[model samples]
Target: MTTFDKVVELLVDAKDCEKDSIKLESTWADLSLDSLDTVELVMNLEDEFGIQLEMNESLKTVGDVVRAIDEGLEQK
Candidate 1:
């Protein structure tokens, strides 16, 4: 599966959301993801992708996460 697909799966599992409800461009606000859920999702992503997420860095959107993963893949 693609990174975006993995992200969707992570979010859906973390939030108990339906697959159809998750979209790559969807904002956290749109997904109604709480702060704790966001943290959990980020952690899951890090674990699944084998990439470290900087806690100090700001990630405001799903697209931002996708871009980060894409960059990480390039490094691998």
Candidate 2:
């Protein structure tokens, strides 16, 4: 699956939320995820993508996460 698709799956599985609500523009607040949840999700993304991610405040939306993963994969 694509990066966005994988991110969506991870978020849905972790949060037990619907896939329809997880768009690129969707923010953490929109998904009802707090800082702890965001941290766990980042760990999951690192393991899932086999890439390290330096957590940042700018990553406020799902699209940002996807972009980070894509950039990580590119570096690998």
Candidate 3:
């Protein structure tokens, strides 16, 4: 699966949410992800992609996370 798909998968698993409910436009708040959950997700992404992510408010959507990972990959 692509990075976007993997991120979505991780989010779903991390939040214990429905897989079908996750979309590119879905917001972290909408997914019920708190600060701790976001941190956990970031750690998972870091481990999976071998990139560190600065936890910022700018990442409001799933697409944002995907783009961040893509950019991180490009830098690598």
Off by over 4 Å in 2: none
**TM-score preference between candidates 2 and 3, better one:** 2
Deviation from native of the Cα of residue 31 in model 1, angstroms: 0.7
Displacement of residue 41 (Cα, Å) in model 1 is 0.7
Candidate 3 Cα deviation (angstroms), residue 3:
1.1
Which candidate has the top score in TM-score? Answer: 2
Clash-forming residue pairs, model 2? none
| Candidate 2 C-alpha lDDT tens digits along 1-76 | 8999999999888888689999999999999999999999999999999999989898999999999999999999
Q: Please provide, for model 3 over 1-76, each residue's C-alpha lDDT reduced to its tens digit, 9 standing for 90 to 100.
A: 8987899788777678788888888888888888888888988999999998878998888888899989998999
Q: Estimate each model's TM-score.
A: 0.82, 0.97, 0.91
Whole-model Cα lDDT per candidate?
Answer: 0.78, 0.93, 0.86
lDDT of 3 at 46: 93
> C-alpha displacement of 14 in model 2, angstroms?
1.3
Residue pair clashes in candidate 1? none
Query: On residues 1-76, what C-alpha lDDT tens digit does candidate 1 reach at each position?
Result: 8888888878777787778977767777888887777788888888888887754346767777888888877887
- The stretch of ten residues in a row with the least summed lDDT in candidate 1 is 54-63
